[model samples]
Target: MAIAPQWEAALQAVQSPPAQRRPGRPRATGHPTDRYEAKRKAILDAAARLFTLRGYEATSVRDISREAGISQATLYHYTGSKPEILAAIHNLMADELLPRMNGILQSDLSPERKLAEYMRAEMELIERHPTYTAAMRHKRWLLPGAAQEMREKRDEADRILDAILQEGIDKGVFHPFNVKFARLAIMGMSNYIGTWFSPVGPSTIPEIADGFARILLQGLLSASPHR
Candidate 1:
């Protein structure tokens, strides 16, 4: 997957060295904590890129270390194991979606509007973080605990969507449908976008999101015969 412009800028920024210290006193390398955070972010960026290009199961610690341009020891100092890194990436994807989804759910908007906003947010997320979405699709099976945590977060997101759908049904704004299946259909559609969406494609994220929301709320069948 092509790296987004912002990610490209971030990778370059982290690779650049700190400013030279003044000659008079002692050389400074900035704060140790800042250096550690930069290195950690770099590792995650590399891991997400590699995991997107190569299957997560096939990527090794050595691969990540090399991609990050750090020694194996240095990589280990930041992230202990490959699975741990994968877990972090999974959490990162979840963190990006959860807060926005929760806010939409908690808002005073009507159910249909809430669902539309949620769909837009989700589509935008997939557009911005395709690599993370791809990595999540090919999850590592070895980490059961980590997998369970991710599943729980996913379920919570689904519940919020389901609640909105149910509210729509109750209010007669939407057809009565199985909320669980509706939620699954919406999520499955959004998830599949990672496989084909292009940053430089003709359609923008909002365009895609609007099309999806329209399809979800209105069936594709023509309402009348052609004139």
Candidate 2:
């Protein structure tokens, strides 16, 4: 049977072993700004991996330290607590994702194209950061105080999408629908990509992006009664 073009490569990447985990130490003073940023990114990456694989309640500071190759004290130095680490993980995701989403909002593309671009971008982002995806999967059920700020940031993200969808309606590019429901449906489709998408599989990122765009556009585009 022919494989679906949407998820093949993502599936493969998920199954493969991740690269070496990041260590827990701060960068040497001499390192470039980008290098310092890279190390911080690595720590967050490792924290996401551990927090996702093991529930927030079950995963300990030591586990994150071990996965990140740093001392627990060092982890504390970077981020005060495991809860704080979770916050940082979600913040990292928001930092990268929201701006790209904002860019899409401002583009003059057709509404359907914009929607498609958003979905495709969302998938690519999740695939690149599966650990964040995992944590997000359980976001509502997260331990108290662990995800509050992240949730706030995510709400802001949703507002951006809501505005775009509203624009599509105002412009007659989409059938009028409740903005909240529309936003949920769009996000549901893309956010779930992390649960299944793999980078090593047959489907390339562009392919998956294109496929998702088609599906979303088909649903959202204003239809012509005449075929």
Candidate 3:
């Protein structure tokens, strides 16, 4: 399946050879990766907040450092550069998201159930890390190197979704439609949760996921193409 047209330029840029990396401080602990991961998470979380608050282009390293409650040099100690930081935010999402996608794909559940679970998993991740999800959702402005590196990590979800959708379509479980558009539409609806959804508000993630899945399936299961 084709990616959305608007990302073509960004895709082309990513196909080229990527630049080399600037290594950060070596891992300090022998077993517990959490210390390093936690620090990285802190930097990434701070960057996510800044990235979403101010546009990625407008947000600066200094802003991220300040938001993260660290000196600029300390920030660099945890992260290499701005693009790397942005990439880390998305990578963090991908790291959490892909496994759930895989699990849903592999399950014996019906397409509708699989999809409902997918939404639950995605929104749960988003709810846990809303700014991070929002930053990744709205921004695609990474360097060629970072972008190239991230392509597979990010696209893995789409790949799984395509497989699921195609399988459902083949089995006549879901109505025939453009798989790419369907994927985009489903993801588009969920990604917006970062902006409007609130944990303390009326709807919970599971409820929202079920609601969204029901709404989408209503259209997917529609008998008439004219609708």
Candidate 4:
């Protein structure tokens, strides 16, 4: 996740703003909280687009400010630095997906069905939030202290998947294998959708999800002793 040197320099510059401001600043007319949130969302939306379309390192704070229709100073008021903007984007994805995923994990469906549903749910999330998912997948290294928290969230998801795999093995529904490796394999396949999937592509999200579930749950090899 090492950000490009240029982006690293931009981050450093944004982090260290001038200590003084000119006198006679104009006062706000609207409620501070509402105005603040609106501006924050605008910055995040703009940053997500830039970070996804252009690499995080290549996208400057000025670029984000222009895209957001706010001055660089105003952007700083909402987000302290470029890294904070990136972190907020990651947080947005986590806030949207984690609770739903927890619910999926707690569902009473059999492990096999649960896994398929989980895969479908993830695919749907990616389809709905392509920018956010792309940022999560690609710019994770830009998050400094927050990277550990993100990893913890990922580990939590992994544990849920591991539980499903173990339950399947316990019930003799899924053939035994290394559960950890299996979880990684399944996750690797699903997480990669953001890189190449398109809404207008040949197949829909559900079609891809179904295909992925079938491949993961049912082997490609014929009925054999290994299976």
Report the number of clashing residue pairs per model: 0, 12, 0, 0
TM-score for each candidate, following the candidate numbering:
0.80, 0.77, 0.75, 0.76
- Pitting candidate 1 against candidate 3, the one with the higher TM-score is 1
For each candidate in the order shown, give its overall lDDT on alpha carbons: 0.74, 0.70, 0.75, 0.73
Number of clashing residue pairs, candidate 2: 12
Residue-wise C-alpha lDDT for candidate 4, range 81-152, written one tens digit per residue:
998888888777777777877787788887767888788778888777666665665555566688877778
Ranking by lDDT: 3, 1, 4, 2
Candidate 1, residue 120: Cα displacement in angstroms equals 1.7
RMSD of 1: 5.9
* Per-residue accuracy of model 3 over 1-227 as CA lDDT, tens digit each: 23233333433432333223346865566656778677777778777766665668878999877776677897898897988888777777788888888999999988878888988888899777656665775446887877876787758888888888777777677899999999999988887676567556788889999999999888776364321
Ranking 3 against 4 by lDDT, winner: 3
Full-model lDDT, candidate 3: 0.75
Index of the highest-TM-score prediction: 1
The TM-score measured for candidate 3 stands at 0.75
Model 1 stretches astray by more than 4 angstroms: 1-35, 220-227
Report lDDT (Cα) of residue 183, candidate 3.
93
